[model samples]
Target: MPRPRGHPRSLRARPELQRLEPKVLLTTFTLTSPTRGALLPAGVSPVGGIVIDLIGEGGSRVVSQIRARDLFVGDFEGGNPPESRGNPGTIGERPGFSPAVVDALGGALAELSVRLTVDDGDTGPGDFDRDDNTLLLNGIAVGRFDRVPTVETDASGTAILSENPEGGFRNDRVDTGFFHVTDPEVLRLVLDSIRDTGAIVVQLLDDDPGDNFFDFTVGIDAALIDVDLPPEPQNRSPRITSLRVEEPVVEGRPSRVIVSASDPDADDAITFRFALEGDGRIEPSETPGEAWLTVPRDGTVRLSVRVEDDRGAFDEAGRAVVVRNAAPSVTVAADQDAIEGREAILAIGSFDDPGLEDGWSVAVDWGDGSAVETFPVDRPGPIPPRPHRYLQDGDYSVTVRVSDGADASEASALVRVRNAPPALQQVLAPRRVTLGTPVDLAAAVSDPGILDPLTVSIDWGAGEPSRIDLPPGSTAFESAFLYDRIGSFVITVTVSDDRQESAVLGVPVTVEAPEPVPPAQAADQALAEALLPADPADPRPATLAIAPDGPGRPAPAPSPSPATLAAPIATLVGQDAPDPAPRASSPPPIPVEAPSAVVSAEQTAPAAPPPPTESAGVAAGSAEAPDAAAVGPEAIASASPSPAVVDPGPDPDPDATMAPETATVAPAVGAADAAEAASSTAVAAGDDDPGAETRSGAMRATVLIVAALTVRRGGSRIRQSLRSASVRSARS
Candidate 1:
């Protein structure tokens, strides 16, 4: 039975008093986690019972008779099954404590006693019928509670949980409040004797000594009571035992902060609220006392936090730290109008930085196959212009990288490398030349890059340019002159490279006027043409004339000597032929284009020519034929091999004389055929463009060659005729 609750009127007799004012509690004795056999024949449910004894102030014991509350079966694993009934530590039973309330022998409630009980070893319903198995017997224990969440000794403390606890409609344990104590100091005294008793246990035995069953460990428990006691020591707020913010929190970088806090109340749950006094963020990590804090920019920041307990108590702590320097920010723009082969300069457009003294460097990649250029900057100010030289033309992406000691940023700008036009060097031709004189034209060209192939068109202030000899890997090209008319001429040279980059240059040259041609010379020129060649259908022979060897030598007059007229007398072996027909000539210059002037027939002369009767004339066809006293020079030149059919080979020595055999041509029908070929060539060329002296001069040369060939053949024929006549006479 529970006694009424009351506090003593006075402690004046406290020293002599054996116990405090009376108190009562609904006592509970439960058998839980009963393992072994429950002292039965096999592993089965046990009929449990409890015996409660309240020992008051002076160790005086009061035996309380309470039949086992749950006298039913339990499962094989030492727990009561849901359908069966047993004691698995469910509280709330008959109120039966403090019978003598306080023992008279002691001033305070001294001790309490509990014993577990189970039915006898008999199975089934007869188990608990025998009263002899009412109480826990000897020293051997049956089983134990494997795990316990927590245990406490506070005055109003509640047990977290013990093994084998249960709940019902009005559950005894409410959220970890399984066991409660009104006055822990009094309870401590009550349990003092058993606490040090070293693994105290409760067990029961059957008649068979060999099979010891129903052995269990009965635990000491706290009880709910009504008592008037001093207020519990106030719970203390959680403390920041060691608040540490890792140093060197760089801008935009994560830094670690650890908090060490504790609550004075052992059961208090601690939590932390982190905040920052700067432009930063605090994120709680998975770990309880750790967090990550990041500041966006460089500056001093304060990390403040509050450690709180479940109770309304808290402690605040804060720390100030300077964030490390951030990478300096700078805006970059580039010069788009960059010229090739010249320095392309980059200008720094704008800059924004937090650290004025941060050491920084800027690297520029010109992207023009050049090396990267880097410049060190002491601080945020006017950065020196970075420059690179691009030798080739192109569009480039200029990459600019700006880096402080710790961080770097990159920007790109598109820069176009304007193509550099070809450079025209000095023209190597003479400033002055005689009229009708073949001029050599040349000028140097450079493309401002590696030696690249070039296209060149050189105009000697005259006619169309048919060919230009610009060798591979050469910087300059040459063109021989063919000025139709002489004057103060301006030679134009156009140059270009594969990149379509072009340049033009003009060079002035004065052509001195020529002495006039006499009427006689004109007559000679006309005669040279008529005597030049015969149409293949009908052929004829013409007269020969010799030119003055030098200005001091008198000119030789033209005359139809027997040797000259004998050209028609020459005979062939197989049939009667007037003259060896001249080889066919190139198709008449088809006027493919109406150019300003005619193309000069490519020409070569190893040396000056000799008279027709000389051994040299008997051999090679030389272009320097005294053109019928200087009129056939053009004709003879035309008679020489056309450049179209010949590989002009290597240039020959101008001062070296070619052997007559060296220039020997095929069988000739006098110089007449050569002259005819030249004449036709000249007529066609002049029809296209008359007064083209370059063509006329070449025609004159070809004529002389024809006339010389005719004479040579005539002489051979004359000898053969004489030999035939003499042989006939001897045979007669």
Candidate 2:
């Protein structure tokens, strides 16, 4: 035989005689002894060819009948058996084969089929004619014209082999119809048949059950599917419930904006971020619920409030707020003119705002250095005027400042004050008067704005003045100046109010010396004197006296006889002498001489009693006769008689009778004689002469006559006698 293409050379060289020899190829065998079985030998090559060899006496010469149905050929090893271990080929047995060989043969056939398929060609009864006897080399049928061989079992249980000189196995003879009988019953029958055809003996060892094979031609189809997802949660918008501003809309100040929302799933509260319409900067607020933003002095600002939820959803709300540029207005006025040292009240007016409840105030500056006062208007009412007093005196600018809630305004006034001159009034009376005379001075003035008049004083240019009430309509006054000294003096009078004084007014007064002492008797002088004393030598008399001379007798003969004369002239000069003499002698007894020639009756009549003399004598008649009888010639001669022939002086009657001359003479003589006798006796006793006595007596008679004549000439000798007796008694 030639090797095929790409075959090895070791499989190509063999002798023709070896190829033609009948090699007792055990194609089929049956066992009559012990049991039916099959043999699997090495180096057998076929798809499905069963080879048998006889052995063991109990494995009798059993006539094994091989049927075509009992033999299989192909690559039996490629077929899986029904059991988990492996699939064994079936071998049919004749009835004469023992049960043991039947079982052994069945296993041997399966083994030989597996070995033959791996090594030789398939040789079985079914692979050739059934009635013909055949011989084979190995399991291949011998032929010259390509004829298949057939085999038969003799009674001795020998296999008769025959070859057919005909075309048999094809060149491409593949047993494509090889089927593995996994049915246990069918597989047992095939084993029985192999046991009976026991030319080759088989021993029943452990079965190699085949792996369980499943034809999983059916599959499941899988794909990834997608369904639509729920729509994403939408962002919720924030709500603005209320908006409020904390402060009044001052143009440039920061204000607060508050926003609210109703997001249950909110992670952050709403915040308001603000921006002015014209500004460039954006300010962020820190407050979560409310935000305060500074407003600019411009247009309205846009406020955006944003709130964010936990699901990363955000929402925003917006609003606009306006900012104004103008501030509040203020005006001020005063209730009175601005005067120095006087109160001025100020009234304030201002704009109103509800946000700023405590509104405006007023301050008054009185142009003096003083503190300012402030007022607050928290409610609706009139603002009390602020009063200020300026201490200085001059033109002053009084400033009043009124304030709004935010700012202030000012106004001023000019206050003029003229200096108040002191009020002056002069008080005086009798503008002119004699010096040293009293005059009244008074004044009437009024300071209506100052204290009372008692507080004022007067200065009369003299000293402090005494207070006085002013008379009606009198402004100037006069007071006494006893200007005893002669000169001119200016009287200056001034009136004073406490704050100021009046100008001095000079009143010139010329004081003259008083008129010389007026005559004392003058009307005015009398008055003056009444007030003074009287003069000493006022030679004026108050009374006067007169005297007359004696009566008759031709002034009584300037010269009389010395006897007739009275006493000596010295005696006549004496303060004691009686002015008139007394008649001491009795009346003459003589009658008046008759007209006829008769002797004078006086010569013839008796004489009166005589005045007693120092000598004792009684004159009786006639001036010469001491007594008629005694009338001697000598006595008569001795007596100084008057010259005779005398007429009777102033006798109213001449016829008066004459007394008897004789009787008158007798008594006188007797008286003389007695005196003589007594004297004689005294002489005898040593007495002086009686005749001398008589003559002495006669002288005594004449002395008596003279004394009587003196008495008669003088008046009243009785007064002289009484004056003499009173002197004698006083002396005694």
Which model scores highest in TM-score? 1
Model 2 misses residue 152 by how many Å?
Answer: 94
Q: Give the alpha carbon lDDT tens digit for every residue of 105-135 in model 2.
A: 3242221111111111223334332222222
Please provide, for model 1 over 1-732, each residue's C-alpha lDDT reduced to its tens digit, 9 standing for 90 to 100: 111233111110001111112422211112111111001111111112233333334323233322333332332234343332132222112232232223221344333333332211222222321222221212322112111111211122212222222211011221111111124364454433223341112232222222212311112122222111111112344556677878767787788999888765678898988999968899999999889988877779888888777865566777787888766566667557776667756665444455434467888887876788888877665667766777766777877777876777777778777766678876788888787788887677676554455788776656775445344356776677756666898878777776767787888888888865533324443454344422232223333222111222332232221112212111121111122334422222111111111111121211222212111111122222223332211111112212221111232322111111111111222344334433444454456554534544433443343333333333333222222211221121
Give all candidates' CA lDDT scores. 0.41, 0.31
- Local lDDT at 633 for model 1: 19
Q: Give the Cα-based TM-score of candidate 1 against the true structure.
A: 0.33
Q: Which segments of candidate 2 are over 4 A away from where they belong? A: 1-314, 317-329, 334-336, 339-355, 359-361, 374-376, 379-382, 388-393, 401-421, 425-732
Q: After superposition, how far is residue 224 of candidate 1 from its true place, in Å?
A: 37
* lDDT of predicted model 1: 0.41
Candidate 2, poorest ten consecutive residues by summed lDDT:
542-551
